[model samples]
Target: MRIDCPHCGLRSNEEFTIKGEVPKARPDAEAGQDAYVDYVYIDKNTRGRNVEHWHHSGGCRAWLVVERNTITHEIYSVIDVQEAQ
Candidate 1:
């Protein structure tokens, strides 16, 4: 697998570290323990297209947003996390 880091050009997947799926929103601090527990421990693990956080640890060391097919491992797009916002 390969990832096209916007700042470092194309690189091997080994250069990156998977940081898991991006959360829709973070739970509020006052939302209580159950809410926090669910947010921290639960895994949605949905199949199909998913957006994830990847760190270019072996390259530019930048955080990226990777949009890819979970089942096929087909990367649709890779962009710097800041640019993604």
Candidate 2:
């Protein structure tokens, strides 16, 4: 697998670290058990396209939002989260 890093360009997936899915929003602690469960386990495991959090461990050490195709394990885009917004 390969991912194109905004700073470091395209590189082997081994150079990056999977940091799990990006949460849509922060959960409120007061929301209790249901909220905690959703926050911890509810994620769209879509096969085609998805946004995931990844760290370029072997490059710039920046967090990136990667657009990937899970089925083929191909990365389409990678942008630094800091600059994305």
Candidate 3:
């Protein structure tokens, strides 16, 4: 697998680090038990094209937006998360 890093250019996927999903805002700490439950267990382990956060640990140390097909282990795109939006 390969990923294109904005700072370091194209490189092997091994050069990056998986940082899990780029989550939305978290519920308030004082919102109670449900908030804690959701925070700990809510995650979308999607099988098709999905957006995930990754870091180029072995390259430029920049965070990347990885568009991957989880089931086939095929990566469609890799771009800097900051520049993606």
Number of the top candidate by lDDT?
Answer: 1
TM-score of candidate 1 on Cα atoms, chains taken together: 0.87
Clashing pairs in 3: none
Off by over 4 Å in 3: 28-31
List TM-scores for all candidates, in order.
0.87, 0.82, 0.77
Q: For model 3, how does the per-residue alpha-carbon lDDT over 18-49 read when each residue is reduced to its tens digit?
A: 98877756888788998778777887877788
Q: What are the RMSDs of all candidates, in order?
A: 1.4, 1.8, 2.2
Q: Lowest summed lDDT over 10 consecutive residues: which window, candidate 2?
A: 20-29
Give lDDT tens digits, candidate 1, residues 1-85. Answer: 8899999998999999999988767788799998988888887887999999999999889999999999998999999999988
Best by TM-score: 1
- The lDDT of model 3 is 0.82
Worst 10 residues of 3 by lDDT: 20-29
Residue-pair clashes per prediction, in order, are 0, 0, 0
**Per-residue CA lDDT of candidate 2, range 33-81, in tens?**
9888887888866768888899999888999998888888877778899
Which regions in candidate 2 have their CA more than 4 angstroms from the true location?
28-30
Q: Of the pair 1 and 3, which is ahead by lDDT?
A: 1
Higher lDDT: candidate 2 or 3? 2
